[model samples]
Target: MERKNLVIVGGGSTYTLGIIMSLIEEKENFPLQNLTFYDTDADRQEKIAKATEILLSEHYPELESFSYTTDKAAAFADIDAAFVQIRTGGLAMRELDEQIPLQHGVVGQETCGAGGMAYGLRSIKDMIDLVNDIRYYSRDAWILNYTNPAAIVGLALKREFPDDLRILNICDMPIAIMKSYADLLEKDVWELVPEYFGLNHFGWFSKLLDKAGNDLTDEIKDKIINGDFLPTDKEIANDESWIQTFRQARQMLIDFPEFLPNTYLQYYLYPDDLAKKESPDNTRARQVINGREKRVHEHCDQIIQQGTAKDIDVEADIHGVYMIRAAASLLFNLKETFVVMVENQGVISNLPADALVEVPALLTNHGPKAFSVGEIPVFYKGLIENQHAYERLVVEAYYENSYNKLLQALTLNRTIVSAPKAKAILDDLIEANKDYWPALK
Candidate 1:
């Protein structure tokens, strides 16, 4: 078996710890030849790199190499797989993530609405730079991008780096939700085989069936509608009010029989309503930044404080498993269905060919073959059409450096007040993200 050289771009991330742990747990299936960590923040990367080395050395000593570096060229060189989970700007910009969307009366949240758009702007340049580096150094390496504003980032990379065969963008939200549903219904995820379709965060469970061929949509719908489901303890749900909002959305799904709503749709569909509700007393982002993010940072601080610290026990988290599976399927020519973002390519008959759609795809050495998703509900078509336009405009704006396209992306978002309001918010975002974004002056 050929050894896999895995390079994690945002290796210092708390999320990375889980991915490393998962890889270790599944070492028998996917053995890694070497592991490397790269982050712009040397101090932070050093901590995770050290910790990971300690963990891997104690357990999987056969691993060929372990290195952490700030140099982009050195980090990406000869890498077979790259997992990207970078937040272009730190949490200091999170206030902007909230306020900007609220300015447009959009449900202001961290990763889903206008805030995500803002974050996307900041990330595009850096993501492109990283991808370009991989292409330059490791021409055959696959880039598994799990970065935020996933749709925009995926689309941007597809458009800009069309010839690059190595990039695949993924998100854990849908997968995580599906796993929760599976656990609730007492079935393995593989057995539940779902037919899901739509854009990034805004997607639906079109069909869900067990291995025995029993349809479970109605049961799942009932649970969602009646609010009978319990929040996962792993999820930081400190806000009872947010929980109630979820319940309300569930009620809407029940009342409106045609479409099943995703948790994120509430942000766009009822922006003004959710914004007026106070910020959740506890948000996942806050919990993560305060708890895991802080701990990771403190661990780094300790390494710096002591001049050097031994590698601590670390494990690959499951978050990056989807990417690993995709790569394995492609490399070994295994036939497997994985969720991927690609050009509609007629997969969804109703969507435009150019529009990027998230749907199940068959992976093989030849690459991803997007499977067709039969006609979607009319309501979902409308939502996808509206959001697809915004996503395309964002990519156009970034690539062409067009202010008009940028404004169009903002205007298409359901949260914008009007053309004038959209332009105002666009100006603010442009200014706020000036450092990270290309000159849109």
Candidate 2:
């Protein structure tokens, strides 16, 4: 078997560490020839690079690894797979992440609505640069992007890159929630296959069934509404307000009875409530970010520090491991039927030809063959239309540097206030992200 070279952009990112750890644990199944880490920040990347080398050496000594500069010619050379997880700006801009949406009285999430548009504007140019670099260095390499504003990035790649360049955008929110749901149901997650669609974190599970063909949505819904479900973890549950958000959304689900909504849907589905100044403080976005994001950063810091001290634990808590497993099963083991995002190409029957829809797919050595989702609910279709338009505008704004298109994308976001407020926020965000973003007029 030929060895594969995996290149990780944004090497210092905690998510990258998680993926590396996952790969190490599954070393026997997917042995790597070489691992290369690339990041523009030398000091931060150096710390993670050293720590990763020490950790991998102690755990999986057979694989070779190195970390290098972000220079395209050096970092991307001869890569087989590239994992991208770059943040356009640093934690210094976190205030913008929180404040901008609060200014509009919305839920104020870091990766949705106004904040996400801001992020998209900044990230698009960098992502394109990296993508172009991959094509320049290794034209055949697969680019697995786990960036925020995933729908926009995916759209940009589809429009700009060659069809066979192999770009797949992913988010772990679905998998994370699915595991929690599986634990609540007392069933192995693998046994519960889900049929879901919509954009990234904003998606809903359309269908869920056990391997034996039993519908568990009702049972899960019952548990959620009754507040009988325990928190996924005590740390996450510590914030009482956050727990109530779940309870409130569960109530909404009971009322609708048509779909099971994600946590993020509250921002869109209840925009008035989420965006009202007097909208009785439910779980604010900061609470969730603090509870989840803070812990993740802490974990990464610990991993780097501990690994540097020779206390190496190369264990990864990443959903990408499951994706790799599914890919391997489909390609090597010849198993069929997994949910994946691929080109529409009549896969969804009704969705636009260029729209990237999530549906059941059959994976072979050639790649994924997406199956049709047929007709989705009217509400979902409406939501998809809004989101898809915003995403397309974002890509256009980035690729073309059209400020008007960027404003349109921001204004189109359900959580954004209106055209005027969107314009104000865009101005502020552009200034904040000047270093990362392309020059905009």
Top lDDT model: 1
What is candidate 1's lDDT per residue for 237-283, written digit by digit as tens?
33454456456657657656555555677777777777776353344
* TM-score leader: 1
Query: Where is model 2 more than 4 Å wrong at Cα?
Result: 66-71, 228-249, 275-315, 326-338, 439-441
User: What is candidate 2's TM-score against the reference?
Assistant: 0.86
TM-score each candidate: 0.89, 0.86
Candidate 1 structure, TM-score to reference: 0.89
Error of 1 at 302 (Å): 9.1
Kindly give the stretch of ten consecutive residues in candidate 2 with the minimal lDDT sum: 277-286
Local error of candidate 1 at residue 410 (angstroms): 1.3
- Candidate 1 regions exceeding 4 Å error are 230-249, 258-260, 278-287, 295-318
Over 120-235, each residue of candidate 2 has an lDDT whose tens digit, in order, gives 66777778888988889898777777777677777777777746636766666666566667887887776877777766667777777898888898888777777644345323
How many steric clashes between backbone atoms does each model show?
Answer: 13, 2
